[model samples]
Target chain A: MDSLDIVFTGFLISALRSATPLLLTLLGECLGQRTGVINLGAEGQMLVGAMAGYGATAAFGNPWVGLLAGAGAGVALSAVHALLVVGAQANQFASGLAVWMLGFGLSAYFGAALVGQQVTAFDSIDVGAAAQWPVIGSVIAGMTPTVLLALLLVPVIGLWFYRTRTGLRWRAVGESPAAARAAGVSPATVQIQAVLVGGLLSGLGGAALSVDYTRTWAEGMSAGRGLVAVGLVIVARWNPWWTLPAALLFGGAEALSLRLQTADTPISAQLLHILPYLVSLVVLTLTCLRRSDSGTPAGLKAVMDR
Target chain B: MRDLMLSGPGRVVGTTLAVLMLTGAFFLAIGRDPVELMGLIVRSAAGDGYAITESLVRATPILLCALATALPARLGLITVGAEGQLYFGALLGTGFVLANLGATSAAPYMAMIVVAMLAGAAWALLPAVLRSHLGVNETISTLLVNYVAALLVTWVVYGPWKSAANLGWPATADFPEAFKPSTFFDSRVHSGLWIAIGLAVLLHWTFVRTRWGLTLDVLRSNPRAGIAAGLNWRRNVLLTMALGGMLAGLAGILETASIQGRLQANLSAGAGLSGFLVAWLARNHCLRIIPMSLLVGALLASGDGLQMFANVPSSIALVVQGLLFVAVLLVGGYANRLQVRRG
Candidate 1:
């Protein structure tokens, strides 16, 4: 391949890899918001997941176990959120922030020991026949289990949201808890379940970051990607399928930033680093302007309306 | 016991005790003597003059940031944009200092502070406008803007404003001595502490003893009636957000001028978020925020001492801080339930 082709392929591959964590997080936030629970603590959940995943991988010598641990850690954090926001009727935003701080602190504390330790991260799977295909071959060949799983989940979740009875119940609860309760649908149970599942997915995203993407542990390694995912959910207009492109857009910006950093260019790397967040803000504003509160969950409206 | 626990003072004591117990349990789980660590933390945070000064220094930004959060919160707005405002403030203040590098007078210092506050207010107004005009969620918009603001600072420090004297270090030129905020008692604790405390007092008085306080309550509790009463909702939102942003921006600039001596990346050290927590802990009470900010500041300041004296990571401060918030929530929620039951 030519140098230009090589750079282009590298960018594409990195973008896909970067999108994995964001897509997982976006999907999870979408689930939670759809249940009328807006979690501002995804960052915290992701951090704990990243730490737990790395720690478990180091201890068990298995990345899969690490991923599970990450998910568990996320679920544990989200449980606190659910208990406070749902059970105690606490402010969702406050509870979420507390969760984020907890996750951040807990991860930094626990992951301190695991730092500088090496783990055998998840290896990309071989696509035997697909490896020979042109253009898409290289990208397809670089797919890890987590990446494929995340991509597959987009469609699966989309289907579940549109087709399933449970999904319908969740949408109903999100729209109006009182109405749902009158319909004999327990909004509390569904909302709690949605929160836990959201945590699980967020944790999985963090795990993917540590085990599959970076293949290493670092303090606050998830950075603001969890927060970025929160914004992307709005960009996606709370739709499961839309998260795919939304996540990819962010991931592409991230990949392009990294690429530009290495290239001979006058544009500052720090300026490029601002691309993902700035783009998200602009897109989110535009989306909200075009369709004001059209797709917002009614239950969430009550919380934010204040 | 139940009645006492449901009371205001009882809830405060209960939450404090709960947080302490949880922290002890955490230390025990890590195979350390909780008592010794706890004692050490207290001493390190406020044992002596130096420690007290350090705690105060840390508290300054947090106090300002809390005021920032609390201001908008009065109007029932949950804004987590203090961090961004702080950065934007420091960026603008630093930009002013950098531009007037040849000005050998104290006049630029005042101008720099104003510029920074305006910059912060400007940054915060974006979300407020978006929320009021486009019906977007202020919380999410503010949160997103924060990252952008931080990156903006990073871009400047690493690019346009990078000091030639620093030799590749990603920081702007250090402030001239005239630009430095006056410190107290030959320590790092600057005049910013007094400014923060004064602002808190002023705000508390305004919130409790003024017509504006009643205005905010009416707007928050009954927006339709408030609108009918000739109160402008959008204008109030904009004013509160801007004022809050100004406080956070002041924090950013002061920290930059006093502690950092130059604008650099990660300057606020999570002061904005810490302030938000303190505000919540104080239940958005301006006066209450003072003591809460000090408490949190002491806890954070002790982290370094813990890392030094014990083999514990400094992040334990964060863990403890988080636990404190959760404990407060649990206690506060329980109290609310009890009040409801009584009613």
Candidate 2:
């Protein structure tokens, strides 16, 4: 490949890699929002998950085991959120913020040993000479398992939210829990299930960062991707299908900023680092301002109204 | 069943005790001596004048930040962007002083403080504008602005504002001696503490006395009725958020003017989050913010000592705060239900 082509291809691959965590997080957040339980603790969930994954991997020398442990850690934190918001009917934002702080503290406290230590991260898939084929090859060749899984989820979640009977009930719960209850579908169960699964996905996203992408643990490593996924959920208009493109857009922003650093842009490096967040703000603003198809979910409206 | 407990204060005390016991249990769970560290935590925060001074220095900004948070919350808004506002405040303060390097006087310092507050307010108002006009979620947008604020600080200090004396370090030039706030009691205690106290008292007064304050109270208790009564909510949202942002910015300016005396990478250092916690724990009441700020400040200061006393990460405090916040919310739920039942 020519040097320019090589750069573009490399950028595309890295962008996908960067977007992997966000994809997982965005989907998880969308599920929770769909259930009418807004989770702002994704950052904490990811942080703890990253630590659990890294620590487990280091202790057991098995990345899969570590990943499961990470997801378990996420479920654990999200359970606290469910107990508070669902069981106690506490303020959602405050509870979520508490979860975030707990995750921050838990990770920093527990992951102190894992800092500066490297885990056996995911290696790229070997497709041999088939990967050498031009444009499509760059996308397929040497991609990690997480990236492939995230790609699969785009279709799977879309199907799960659209094709399944359970998915319709999930939408019913999000739109109007009282109505869902009247229809004999338990809103509480749907909400609890959605938040739990969403937390697991968020935890997996954290593992993606530490074990699959960065191959190392750092305190606060989620770096607000959890929050970014939240904004993406709004931009996606609470649809699971929309998460795919929105996450990739954020991922593209991430890749462009990284490329900008090495490409000799006149903008200060610090300014460039903020590019993804700025993009999130712009996209969020535009999405909110645009008068669109369906109104916000009934459950969300009820909570926001209060 | 026969005896009823008094309400809010009783719950507060009970929650405090519960948190302490829970924290002690946590220390035990972690296989550390709870008593040793618990004693050390109190001692490190206030056993001596030096520790007290350091904590007061820390509490000054937190008090201001709590006011910043509490104000917006009173008007039914969640403004957690104090971290961003503080940075912008500090950045403007430093920039203003840098721009007038040749002229050194307290007059310029006053102007710089005013600009710092304004910058903080403007940064805060940016989010409010979206929330009020477009119905945007302030929680997430204000948070996004924090990263932007942090980056802007880095960009300024390392790029345009880099000083000759920095010696390859990423720092803005030192402020002129003229602008530095005077120290109190001939120690590290600065006059900024008084400014923080002054603002806290001023806010408490405004919440009780002013028409705007009365409007905020009405808005808080019954936003629908207030709106039904033809109160202008959009302007009020803007005012509360801007004022809150200004307080947070003033906190930043005080830190810049007193502590750091120049801009650096570690501008915020968890003050914004701590401020939010303070405001929450204080129930967003103006009168409660002062004591809550001191308590949270000491809690944070003690966290710093956790590493020294036990080889444990100081972040144990964050976990504790998390636990405490969850408990408070759960406890508050009962109070809300009680109020509704009485009504």
Candidate 3:
């Protein structure tokens, strides 16, 4: 392959890897918002999960256990968020900010102890062998199993959300709590479940980043992926179906940038590094400007004001 | 109805107890004694004149950032991008100081600070313009700008602005001691402290006793009410955000000139977030910001001390701060529930 081809191919492969974390977090935030809670602590939860995942993987010598531990940490952190926002009924923004602070601090503290240690990364599942065709095989060659799992989850979750009795209650609770209450559904219970599920997914996202992608944990490794996920939730209009493609688009931008940097492109590499965020910003602005067609949950903060 | 609420002493006791109990729980979890941690925190904060001075030095930028958000917050506005404004201020301030290297100390340094404030105010104008014109959400715009500012600062440090004198990484040259604020007493505490305090008092006086303050207070609680009272919401929003941006911008300038003396890739070190925390904890009350700023400063100062004495990572303090913040919000929320029930 020519240099440009090789670089483009690499970018495509890596974008899948990069998109995993974003996808996980965005999916999680989607659930949280669907139930009328804006859990801004996704960043903090991811950070904590990253640290826990790294720590557990390091101690147990198994990536699976680490992933579980990471998800547990995410859930614990999210529980704090759920308690404060759902149970205590705090301002969503205020509670979310506080959770972010706690997560950033705790991760750094725990990270101090685990700094410089290396853990085994998860092995990628080969889908190339199953593809039975060259072009498709090449495209799916190094894609992690987590990406496939997360992608599959979108449709299943979407179907479950719209078709199931519980799903109807979830929507009702988010749309109008008074109506939900009158309909004999408890908003608090529904919100708590959404938060718990969201936290689990967020934790899984952090775990994927630490174990499957980065292969090593360091302070602030999640960077602003959690926030990016929040932005994606806005752009996707809290639709799980849209998040998958949005994640791919964002991941693709990041991958493209890294590719350009590696290829010695004349463009300033710094500009490339910012491409994903810029794209998201533009996408968000345009999305906000356009007419809304996808049904946004009534309880979700993004649409509640409108 | 108001009389039944906590009295002044009761509120102080409540806030203190809330802070302490939460801090204690965190320390206890980490296998450290809360009393010892608290003592170490207090002593390290005031263990020596030098330590106390350092705390004040650290606090200079924090106080500024707190006021930045609090100013808008008092008017029921969320200036979530104070961090970005701070960067705009610091970047301009440093650029001005470096560009005017030949000028004598008196005019150039002061001029740089003034320009820094203007740059910050100008940076804030983008969000204000968007909000007033297109009806954009200030929170998201401000946040997006923060990312842009961070990237902009990164560009400056890493690109053409990279110090030609050094080759390995991006960093600006150190400011001359004459241009920089002087350390007060063998610590890095500098004139930024006085500047921050002076600004705080100025803001307090402006918001509490002045006509503008009354107008802002009215606008903050009820924008519709302010409009009904014949206050121009747009002008007041612009002015309040300007003041808020200026404070944060001053923080960035002070941080560069006094603390770091040179701009690095990540000069903020989460001061912007800390400022948000301080503003929230104070509930946007200008006068209350002083003690909260000091308290946060002391905790931050002692984070280093904890690392030094107990071999504990300073980030542990962050966990404590997070716990306190979450707890405080929960309490506030609980209070809201009580009010709802009573009503």
Candidate 4:
């Protein structure tokens, strides 16, 4: 293959891989925020999940077990968050920050031992008919199976969240606990479930980073992807479906930056490295400017302010 | 104050026990002895005067940052960019010295320190301005801006301020010896310790005695009530945030001048965000900050020892912190609900 082809293929694959971690995280965060709780601990949770998943996969030699362990870790942490913010009425911000600190420290401490370790990852399932097409073939050539699963999961969640009976109840609880409680819905249970599912998704997202992206465990590997995911969730305005494009945009910026660094261009490598963060800031600021009430989950503005 | 201390003793013991139990369980599951780890941590952190002094040195910037975070947190502002603010302070402070000092001199060093403080404060002003005016949430904005500041600092260091002689690292020339903080008792601890302690007391006085402080307390309790009571809520929030930023900026200055002595990429010892944690654990009480800072410092010191004694990976500290934070949040949530029920 020519250098151009290699660069293009590398960028495409990196973009897909980078976006997976953020995409999974944002989707989870979307659910958590939709239930009127901001899980700022997404960063911490993702880190812990990454470590847990990596450790489990390495120990058990089963990627699925590792994936489950990661999700379990995420859920466990989310349960703590749920107990604090929903059950005990702790300041969600403070609780979330605490989670971040704890997760960061723990991940770093445990990850040091797991560094230089490798895990077997799932193989990609390429669609042959799709591959026959020109532009579309390029997109799906090395697409991780989990990415497709995530895509399918989004519409299902979107339908479940907005169109189903339980979905309406969850939305109602998130919109106003008082109203929901009066209507015989238990906001606590709804929030607990939302948090649990969010944690599981976040764990899966973290696992994807190890299993699909790097295919190895590294200390502080989550970096700021968890935070970026949280930002994406905000940009998407708690909409599950929007997380895909939002994550892809941010992920593309990241991939482009990496490509620039490798191309040995005259541009400052540091500038390119920070490009995605700059994009996140710009996209976030612009999204904030839209003044669309439709994006915000009903009960979230008050919860966020508090 | 005495009543609160006495009343909270049981809760403190209970919380400590809970932490111990959880940590012990984790250790057992990992086939490590918790008691042995605890002993190793204690020995590394406080077994000798030198170790204790090092602990204090590490705690200095954190204490200052905690104070910075505490001020605005009282008014319900979350500043996660203390890390970034510190970097900006260090960069600007370094720039000030580079600009003013023709030679390595004490006067120039002092000026640079002052400049760093101001720069950090200025960096913080952007987030506060957006939050106060544009109604942007300070938490996410500050968090995002931290990455920006980190990048900006890296840019200046690697681009214009690159040390021509050094290879494979992004760092500026070391600060002149004269700019370094004076050591305490022939120990690694520096004058920054005094600065941190003094700020803690100063904040305590302000929170307790000053009308502005009382107004802030009121604002934190209920913003609408403060507005109804004719308190200038926006102005208070802005000023407090600015002050918080300035304090954080001061931490950045100290790190550059005294400890790292250069515009090191990620220059802070994670003191910026850790300070936020310290401040929160103190329940925004300035008086309690001193001990809280020390506790976190000790934990950090112990984490550093993991590599030496147990041959354990230092990442264990991060895990402990993650566990502690989640546990604390869970505990705090229950505590808050209990408080509500009592009320």
What's the TM-score of chain A alone for every prediction? 0.95, 0.95, 0.92, 0.92
lDDT of 4 at B274: 80
CAPRI class of candidate 1: medium
DockQ of each: 0.74, 0.72, 0.58, 0.60
Winner of 3 and 4 under DockQ: 4
Candidate numbers, best DockQ first, in rank order: 1, 2, 4, 3
User: Least accurate stretch of 10 residues (summed lDDT) in model 1 chain A?
Assistant: A1-10
lDDT of 1: 0.90
- For all candidates, the clash counts are 0, 0, 2, 11
Question: Mind giving the per-residue lDDT tens digits that candidate 1 earns over B171-275?
Answer: 999988888999887999999999999999999999999998999989988989999999999999999999999999999999998899999999988899999
Best by lDDT: 1
Q: List clashing residue pairs in candidate 1.
A: none
lDDT on C-alpha atoms for all candidate structures: 0.90, 0.85, 0.79, 0.79
TM-score per candidate: 0.96, 0.96, 0.94, 0.92
Q: Residues B133-228, candidate 3, lDDT per residue (tens digit)?
A: 555556666766777777778877787567877665787877776677666766788777787878888888988899988988887677787899
| Residue A84 Cα positional deviation in candidate 4, in Å, after optimal superposition | 2.2
What lDDT tens digits, residue by residue, belong to model 3 across residues A1-306?
A: 457665556676788788988898889898888788887788888998888988999999888888899899999999988999888887777787788888888889887878888897667676645645544455566677666767778888888888999888988887899999999999999999998888888988898888778887788888778877876787887778888888987899888888788889987776677788777767766776665636567666443332
TM-score leaderboard ranking: 1, 2, 3, 4
RMSD of 3: 2.6
Clashes by residue pair, model 2: none
Query: In candidate 4, what are the lDDT values of residues B1-343, reduced to their tens digit?
Result: 3333235674565557667777777778778999998778778788889779878988888898889888888898877878878878877888876565455667776777678878878888877887776666788878877887777788878888877656847777777777778887788788988888988999999899999888988898889999999998778767887788778878887877777777777777678778887887787888899998888787787776777778877656555655565555555666655666666
lDDT of 4 by residue, A131-182 (tens): 6665446667768776776777788888888899999888888788899999
The TM-score that candidate 3 achieves is 0.94
Given candidate 3, what's the lDDT at residue B10? 43
